[model samples]
Every structure is written in C-alpha cells, then in structure tokens.
Target: MTVWQDDVARDLVRNVGDRLALLTRGEGSHVWDGDDKRHLDFLAGIAVNSLGHAHPVFVEAIAKQAATLAHVSNYFATPPQLALAARLKRLAGAGIDGRVYFSNSGAEANEAAFKLARLHGIGRNGVAARPRILALENGFHGRTIGSLALTAKKAMREPFEPMPAGVEHIPATIEALEAAIDDRVAAIVVEPIQGEAGVVELPEGYLAAARSLTLKHGALLIVDEIQTGAGRTGAWFGFNHEGITPDAITLAKGIGGGFPIGALVTFGVASSLFTPGSHGSTFGGNPLGTAVANAVLAEIEDAGLVENAARRGAQLREVIERIESPLITGVRGRGLLIGIVLSSPIANAVVAAAQERGLIVNAANPETIRIAPALTIGDAEIAEFETLFTAALADVQASLAASETEKATAP
Candidate 1:
C-alpha cells in the first residue's frame, strides 16, 4: 500500500472499503492521480459533479460567497438561501404553496422527509392515524438511521435491526404498489430510477399508477431524486417525465454540483406538514453552499447542459450499442446516468480494467457497470470514452477466454 492507503488503514473506519486511487486534482471531465496519470472521470463523483471538476463558475461562486457572508445559522436566512429555495421550488414545479427545507446531504434531506411522514401520520386527536411507510424492495435512499429504515436492502438493514418501525418494502411494479398501498400508509417513497440498483428504471406507468394510488389513499408520494435530479436524467428532475407532481421530493447530489447540500422540496399541503421545531440544520442553507449551487445551476441553465445531457446521452447509448462485445447485453437508464448490463458477473474486473486503461467507471452490481459522466461532456469526451471502454471490455473478454481455454485443455 502507498502512504495514503497506509494512513487510511491505520486511522480510518473500516466500514468503507479500500481506496481505488489517490486522485489529487481534477479539471473538466478528467482527474489526475497521485502518480500524475490522467483518467477520464465518467462517474463524476457518483453524479455529484454536475458542472465538472474545478469549474470556473463553481470556484468563483465559492470565493465570492466566502468573502461576503458564509454562515449566519438558520435563525436568520441569507439572500442566497432564499433565492435557492425559490429556484428549487420553481424548477421542481412545486407551485405557489411549495416550501423547501435545506440540509447538508441527501440522507439528512430524507431524514427530514421521514419526519414529514411522521407529521402526516398524526390525526386530529394527535394519534398516529397513518403508521405505515412503503419503499421499493431494492431502492436506496441513504445510509442514515432514518433514511436507512426506508431503504429495503436486507443486508444493509439486518445488522441495524430494531430499525425505526412501520417501514415496509414492496416490489417496483404498479401491481405491487396497488396491492401494498392503503389509507394507513402515511407515505410511499420511491426513486424515479433506482441508481444504486443498476440504474433500473421503474416499469411503465409505475409513477403514474403510484400517484393515483397515493392520491386515492391520501398518502404522500415522495420521490427520491438524489441521483436523478439536477438534469442528470435528461429532466430537471426525474419525475418531470411522468408529468405528475409528487407531494414531496428529496434533492441533493448534482443539485450542489459537487458541494455538500441537500433539500426536501414539498408541494401544496405537504409543505405545511413540518411545523416549527420539527426539523432544522445548522449549516444547511449557509450562504457559501447556496451561492455555489446557485452559480452551478445558473451555468447549467445558460449553457444548455440539460438539453446537452439528453442529446449526448442518446449518442452515448448508440455508440455503446455499436460496440461488438459478447459480454455486453444492453444498456439501461436515462440521460447521463447509464448502466452497461453484462452477460456475466465480471463487473469488478471490467472496472479495474477500465481504471488500468485510464478511464473511470464503477460496477453498480456484479453484472452492471454504471456510467455517469459530467453533464458538461461533449463529443470529445464521448469519443475518448468509447475507445477506452471498448479496450476495457476487450481486456476482460480476453481474460475470460484464456481462463476457459486453460480449463478445456487441462486433464
């Protein structure tokens, strides 16, 4: 191990796995490791770096905001804070009655949403009238205790047993939703695309059916847009494709464009669910983060990155489909958030091989290689990716072929 790895092993917590590479600096769609080797960053910090690394707008905003006013706490809101809330409300189509709650990360945003669900559960007599909360079976919200309770991965939740009660998981299907939802459910949280679950899109009409069911049962329809928000999925928010407004939506990741910020945006009556003292964050809407995010979002709007994401995403899919690789089955996801489905469980090898070839991509699962590049990428980035990714696939295919040959000739 290198010095960084040695330090990490000696001092850091073991929950996180070993480090991949010691990335030192980044600019645009590329980053350099400790060895000064350049690698194309296709993951984009797991869809956080919307504007890419070391963007002038991001840096200028941060410097300007820090020189002016950084933090004044939640007691007194800053202009940037108010402006961002309004911007998010407008972009999310939350309407006139919409409200925004700021937090430092997506997990906190979802945690506040969890509290919102609990608030909605209270009856006229102040009893828990609606106690149930539903989430998709393989959905990932966050790692916080409150958010973790809503996540349905058994391996993740089993160790933290005796989790906050009243949370249930259902299949990601309209029929499953119809069977599971009822008046007793306070809310049903879902991702427009299960980013962590191999960029899986919900079945056709799933969101529309969910909207109808939740509306019929008087349950809040909460959309988790952490990974799919901020133009990552071709839309401003993933729910826009369905044209159905959610009761509330959690925002983070690309919203801050690599900065740490999260928000729970509520529409109509859901805005009033969180009363005073219900939820709060100290550095949630500080001027520094808000100003940077505002600048990042403004750049996205002015530069037409949203439209670019749509066009480039289609071009990328076409390019990947054209590559003749026996290991590749198909591609999934919308816009820049793509998943290359493999015929075998060789995702780890493929990722490693891509890294060796100076391209960065990750395995969403054993057979799914996720690719979420910066929204600013164009034809040049795409061309480079095609070459590197094709080479990576070839490397893995050759290794597999050699292994098969060795076994066939043995004995």
Candidate 2:
C-alpha cells in the first residue's frame, strides 16, 4: 500500500511544504474542501471571484462562448472582444476616443501597458530617450520580467535581477514621487490601494499631486488597478474615487469574474502610444474570456454591486472595530479590501485558527491579516465571519498568554 504522498504526481515537484496540496472544490462567499467541509472565504480567490463561485450568469456566458467561439488570432477580431473593450472604456470613462489591448492576466496587462509607455516615451516621429518607470516601495505590479522590474518587493525582484533597466522605485508619496521623476522617466505606475502591502491606501492628495507632477514632467501616470478595479474598491476603477484620469490603466482580477483576462486602457494622447504592430497577445482578446468579462461588467452594473461594496465594506469595518481586541491594533482598507493589523506577528497563527474554524483569510504580512470578501456577500455572511474572526483572535491571545505564563513559571 502507498500513502498519498507516495503518489507519482506529488513526486514530480520537489517537496516545498505540505501546504500547497490543500485542495478546494467549490466556493461562494465561501468554499468547501475536497472533504466537503464549508469555509467562509474572505480572500475571494485573492479578489478574483468578484461574483463568487458558480455564478450562473458567468457560467452561461463562458459556456456559450466556449461552444460558439473560444479563441482567435490577433489577425481577426471577435464581437465579444470588441464589446468588452467598449464597455471597459465606458466604465473607466475613457470615452469612445480610447483604445484597449487585452491580455491573460494583470501582469500581462501591465507588461503591455509598460511597453506602450516606452513607445510613447520614444515619441512618434523621432528617436527618444529611453524611458524610466517610477514605482513605489512595497508596490506590486506583477510577476513578468517587465512588470517585476516595476515591482518594488525585494523578495520577488532579487531572484530576477537585471530586469528591464530604467525602472525606479520611490516611497509612496507625492513629494517623494515628485523627487524621483527625472526627465528620462516615461511613466509613474501606482496602485490606489497597495493590496499586497497590507492594504495601504495612498496619502490624501497623492493622486492629484501625481497628476500635476507627471504633467509638469511630461510623463504618463499609469494606475495599476489590478486589485482595485471592476467594483472591487466600490468604484469602477480606484482612480475614479480620486477624480484623476491616468494616461493608461491596467486591469484584471475581477474583470473576468474568475475567467483569465486582463486589459490595458488608454485615453487621448496615451491612446496613440502603441501602433498596430507594437504590441499583441495571442490569447488576450479570446472570445471566451472577453465574453465572460462583458457579462461580469453587465452584472455589476445591473445588480449595483459597486454600491453594495461601499455599504458592506463600512459595515464590515464597523463590526471588526467593535471587537476591540487588544490583539487587534487597527483595521485598514477601503471597500471590500480590508486589513486587520495585529499587535504581534502572529497573523499566520490567526489565519490557521480561522481556517480550522471554517473561515478562509490571508495574511498580507507578518502582522496584517487581509480580507477581500466578495462584493456580493450578504449582511449575514459578514456577521458570521466577524464572530468567527473575533473568536479566532481570542484563541491567538490565549495561546500567547499560555506561552508567556509558561516562561514566567519556568524562571
């Protein structure tokens, strides 16, 4: 007899940890493991399942598209692709004057946008100076080489050094960003709320200041809305709340309602940045992906999910704040994207406790437990998680107290 670990499939990859094998079958605002145990999902597939699991509308759209037409090369255009592009422009308020390039993920979207920035930096008529991109510390763009170069996380960068040069990092601030912009810089890439960095919101006036500075420096402002777009942040795009129009915006995550799709949106001068042959993705505008994205956008509008996110986010924050656990230092994040800061670095412990109690959450950092629940989660679901989460924090506190008591009694 052979154990599960003895299987050839598990042997293919070097054993990193016993963690990755955890399998989940179905999820809603929650999910069930292969064991059929239910768990409240606060991560929302890291903010991908905007409509949650098994949404009938998305399923229907994907099924219909896959059956009729799933893919096509760049040489041909499909109706779903055209429709999604138009809808995204309307949602981003890019107007009919804008253009879009589709891709398969946020990183790919950013990669396409980055290349467009470089092209724009070089100018249309003459050879221009190589353009540099100014990204912020703790900012996350994507995993691709170019996007990774714009990303500021050292752990993700050190492994892939000598990344496309000309990318720079500055503190997430208007003044610091202003200081970083040189004549050779082409664009400043920013996330309205830094999701992976513990849901850090940009300082007030930061976007406005960036717009002014970029205008002064003749650079484009590229807002990476990968985690905050498509009603995730209670707005179509995070920049909408800031009242600033960026030169280019990259979007993914919930845009496809769990389908793999990403897009680069541009307006005015930025629209002309890329020529026909400058950039392309084979699977970028596939019928299946775009059709699902189109349905996702329509569902969001018809159901007013963005407004729901705003109202429910406040309610969730209030409920968590009422917990008032000494273990909980504070709660930060906007809309459905939330972060609970703990007094210690035992966030992973809290996450484990929550998971054991049928709740799924993520640790954004050692001390910050992040929750990005589905935008459509009901009031009852939020309350249930609040109770489970508060209790989990108590468990962490009790464990800490017991450990401290053991230390004191030992001496």
Candidate 3:
C-alpha cells in the first residue's frame, strides 16, 4: 500500500511537491512529523508563525471570534476589521489619513497595491499610456498574474505569459533604477530585504536612493514587506529601518500569526485611489482573521517580541560567524531573517543532513540556507541549534572531502 506521502506526491499539484510533508505539527521552535519524530524548526512556517504554533493568545482569540462571528461580507464594517486597520496605520506612521484593504494572502495584497498604483496614475494619463511598474531583479512579489508579472525569475514565469501588462524589471541598484524610471512609470516595487532570494539585504542608502529616483520621476515607491513585515525584521516594517515612507506598503505572513490574511496600506495621496466599490474581499477582513491578528499584535507588543528578535538575531549571527567553516562564505540578514551563503552549491545537501539531525531548515537558493526562526524562540533553542548546525557542517565537510578524493581517483 502506498503511504500518505506517496499518495501526496502522486495526487497533489507538483508545485512545492514534497516540501509540504516535511513538518506536521509545531510548538514554539519545535515540530513533530507523522513518524512521531521531533525536529527543531528554524523555518517557522517560512516566518509566518511569529508567536509560534498553538499560542494561547491566538487560539483564544480565534475561538472567541469564531463563536461571535467568523466572517461577514464587505457590505458592512466590523469592529475587529476596523481595529486592525487602525493599528497597522499607526505602525506605518501613515498618520490618521491612511486607508486599508484586506486580502486573503500576500499575492492578493500586492495585487491590490498594483491596482491602487495604476489608478493613481490614471488621472494624469487618461488611461491611454498607462504607467509601467518597475520591479527589482531577483525580487519576488507574488505568484498571481499581476504580481507574478513583477517577479524576476524566468523559470517561474515563462509558462504564464500575457500577464497583466505594464510591468518591467530592472537591476537592484540606484544606477539601474535611475536609468529605468521615466515619466510613464507608475511605481517601483522592491523588497526591503529580498527574503526568498537568499535573504539579501539592501546596500546602505539603496532605499533612500530608490526613493529619490522615484520622487524625481514622479513614480510611486512600493515597498513589498510581505516577507519582512510584522516585526520579522526587528521593526514594525523593514523599510522603517531606512526611515523612508513608501507610497504603498504590502504586508502578510505573521501578521495574522499563521492565519491567512494580507493588507494593502496606502498613505496620503495614494489613499484615495480606491473609492467605494473599486475593490473588496468577501473574507479578507473577516472577524476571524482580524480578531486573531489583533491578538497577535497585542501579544507581540506585550512580550516585547520586536526587541527580543533584534537581540537574539544578533546573537545568532555572532554564533554562526563563530562556526568559521571554510565552506561558509558569509552570513547575511537582520533580525531573525538570516541567510548563510556557502562557497559551493551544497546547500541542499546541508538541508538534508540537518533534517537527519532532527532540525528543520531551508535552502533559499542553491548556495544559501535561509533561517527565519520564531520570534518567541529562546536561548536554549538557539544554543542547541548552533551545536547541531556546526555538527551538520562537519558532516558536509567530510562528505565533500570524500567526493573530491573519489573524483581524483576516478577511472
């Protein structure tokens, strides 16, 4: 008889095929599989469970809201929905004039933000020559048609052509940006830290430079904080580190503390782009998602998770540097979003070996291991992870040495 994993492989969609069966359940920084085996989770549901799994606050809020009201149509306003929008606006420093739109996922958030940008430019051009969206190379926004058009990976996008038009890709540099922006461009979309592209951090002044270029050309600046927002980068939002406010910000992952939710936040002039009936979601700002999100935000503040993330993230980086392995090229990231770049493309092997040692990790790319652990993780978990991680690297070293010797003695 075929096992559940085999059935999954055969029946489920091939996209992210085997990755879904890796970890079954989670609590704090640990997860257990269907085989009753435990693994220390450094992935944290791809940085979604900031409060960790099965947190009491989240559970209670969801349970209470489920009892009260699970979902309501967009025709009416709900308290939880209004409360979350208010809190996010304050965090964005968008003043009292900001507006919010809810969506079911990150891609939807980017989709809405794109619509807002296009609408903002419509008044100037009369819809004849629409403003083009300029995005960063090696940057990932989302997989939806419109947002996918903004994504730079050719392999992920070639099959889906004729995507919503007016999206352009340029290099991730000030010079590249300065050359790309023109009067017809609507917005420039970027990730504060390119999380999926190996947690690549922006160069100092890169954001400010982009802001300047966009402002000079009258192009809107869109910061896609979907992966790095909600205190994941040790701040309310990743762009806050640069102290630059973007025209629009997209957020998801960890905002709902694992619940499916996304938000499009617009400030000042951009706020009025979406009038009544322009866009809406049936379950986007439901009581269930918003109630839990409100609780998650309150819990983060009460526990000082943002500060803890900064301190622990720095400590974890220092420990990783102490590994001093020749194969390790460098460690790059801020807060808990870390990426350890290797000199060779042995990152997949490292992930397998780490899994064998009862640890869960991810290879963001062929040569980089991304680590975005839970914000609630403590010293003990990190200490154990460092020890196991060093041992895993040693295993990699031994295997590589044997492979080299075999190559030298090849017949």
Candidate 4:
C-alpha cells in the first residue's frame, strides 16, 4: 500500500474499505491521480458532478458566495436559498403551492420524506391512521436509520434489525404495487431507475400505475430522484417522463453538481404535511452550496446539457452495441445513467480493467457496469469513452478466455 492507503487504513473507518486511487486534481471530464496519470471520469462522482470537475461556473459561484455570505443558519433564509427553492419548485412542476425542504445529502432528503409520510399518517384525532409504508424490493434509499428502513436490501438491513417498523418491500411491478397498496399505506417511495440495483428500470407504466393506486388509496407517492435527477436521465427529473406529478420527490446527487446538497420537494397539498418544526438542517440551504448549485443548474440550462445528455446517451448506446465483445450482453438505463450488462459475473474485473486503461466506471452489481458521466459531455468525451471502454472490455474478455484455456488444459 502507498502512504495514503496506509494512513487511511490506520485512521479511517472500515465501512468504506480502501481507496482505489489517490486522485489529486481534476478538470472537465478528466482527473489525475497521485502518479500524475490522467483518467477519463465516466462515473462523474456517482452522478454528482453534473457540470464536470473544476467547472468554471461551479468554482466562480463558490468563490463569489463565500466572499459574500456563506451561512446564516435556517433561522433566516438567504437569497440563494429562496431562489433555489423557487427554481426547484418550478423545475419539479410543483407550481406555486409546492414547498422545498433542504438537506445536506440524499439520505437526509429521504429522512425528511420519511417524516412527511409519518405526518401524513396522522388522523384527525392525531393517531397513526395510516401506518404502512411501501418500497420496492432491491431498492436502495440511503444508509441513515430513517432512510435505511425504506431500503429493501436484506443484506443491508439485516444487521440493523429492529429498524423503524411499518416499511414493506414489494416487487417492482405494477401488480405487486396494486396488491400491496391500501388505504393504510401512508406512502409508497420509488425510484424512476434503480441506480444502485444495476441501473435497473421499472416495469412499463409502473409509475403511472403507482400514481393511480396511491391516489385511489389516498397514499402519497414519493419519487426518489437522487441518481436520476438534474438532467442525468434526459429529464429535469425522472418522474417528468411519465407526466404524472408525484406527491413529493427526494433529490440530491447531480442537483448540486458535486457539492453536497439535498432537498425534499412537495407538490400541492403534500407541501403542507411538514409543520414548521417537523424537519430542518443547519447547512442545508446555506448560501455557499445553494449558490454553487444555482450556478451549476444555470449553466446546464444555458449550455443545453440536458439535450446533450439525451443525444450523447443514444450515441453511447449505439457505440456499446457496436462493440463485438462476447462478454457484453446488452446495455440498459436512460440518458447518461447507463448500465452495461455482462454475460457473466465479471463486472468488477471489467471495472478494474477500465481503471488500468485510464477510464473510471462502476460495478453496480456483479453483472452490471454502471456509467453515469457528466451531462456536459459531448462528442469528444464520448469518443474517448468508446475507445477506452472497448479496450477494457477486450482486456476482460481476453482474461476470461485465458482462464478457461488454463482450466481446460489442466483437465
């Protein structure tokens, strides 16, 4: 291990494991490690870097905001904070009646949503009239206690048994939703695309069906847009594609463009669920983060990165399909959030190989390589990605063939 790895091993928590590379700096769609070797960052900090690394707008906004006003707590809101809330409301189609609650991360945003569900569960007599909450099987919310309760991964939740009660994990199908949802359900939280579950897409008409069911049962339909928001999925928010407005939506990741910020945006009557003291964060809507986020979002709007994500995503899918690697089965996902499905459980091997070839990607699962590049990427970045990813696939394919040959010879 290197000096940095040694220090991390000795000092840091074990939950995250060891660091992969000691990245020192980044600019645009590329980053350089400690060895000064450059890498094309296709993962974009797990879809957080919407404007890419060291973007001038991001930097300038941070500098300007810091120089002016950074934090004044939630007691008094700043211009950036109010402006961002209005911007988010408009973008989410929440209209004039919408409300925005800021948080520092996706987990916190979902935590607020959890509270919203609880608030909505209360009856006229202040009793828990609606006690059940539904989430899809294999869905990932966040690691926080409140958010973790809603996440359905058994392995992740088993250790933390005795979780906040009343959450049920149903299949990601319309039938399953129809079967599970009832008047007793306070809310049903869903993701447009299950980014952590191998960039999996929901069944056709799932959201629409969910909307109808939740509306019929008087349960809130909350959409988790952490990974799919901020133009990552060729839309301002993933739910926009369905044209059905959710009761509430949890957002983070790309919204802040690499900065740490999260928000729970509510539509119509759902906005009034959270009473004043129900939820808040100290640094959530601070001027620094919101200003930077505003600038990042403005840049995305002005530069037409949303359209670019759509066009480039299609081009990327075409490029991946054209590659004649036997290991590649197919590609899935929407816009820049793509999953390259492999025929075998060698996604990690492919990721390591890609790293060796100076490309950054992620293994969302054993058989799925997730790619979430910057929305700002254009023809040049896509071309470079095609070259690097193709080489990486070839390397993994060759390794697999060699392993098979060795086993055959030994037999």
Q: Which stretches of model 1 miss by more than 4 angstroms?
A: none
**Who is ahead in lDDT, 2 or 4?**
4
| Residue lDDT tens for model 2, 318-385 | 99889968988898988999999899899899998898888889989999999998888988899899
Model 1 lDDT tens row, 253-366? 998999999999999999998888888988998899998888898899889999889999999999999999999999999999999999989999999999999999999999
Candidate structures ordered by lDDT, highest first: 1, 4, 3, 2
lDDT of 4 by residue, 305-331 (tens): 888888899999999999988889999
How many collisions between residues are there in candidate 1?
0
- TM-score for candidate 1: 0.99
lDDT of 4: 0.93
Quick one: best lDDT, which candidate?
Answer: 1
**lDDT score, candidate 1, position 63:** 89
Model 3, TM vs. native: 0.96
RMSD, every candidate, angstroms:
0.8, 2.1, 1.5, 0.9
Cα TM-score per model: 0.99, 0.95, 0.96, 0.99
Summing lDDT over every window of 10 consecutive residues in candidate 3, give the lowest-scoring window.
Answer: 16-25
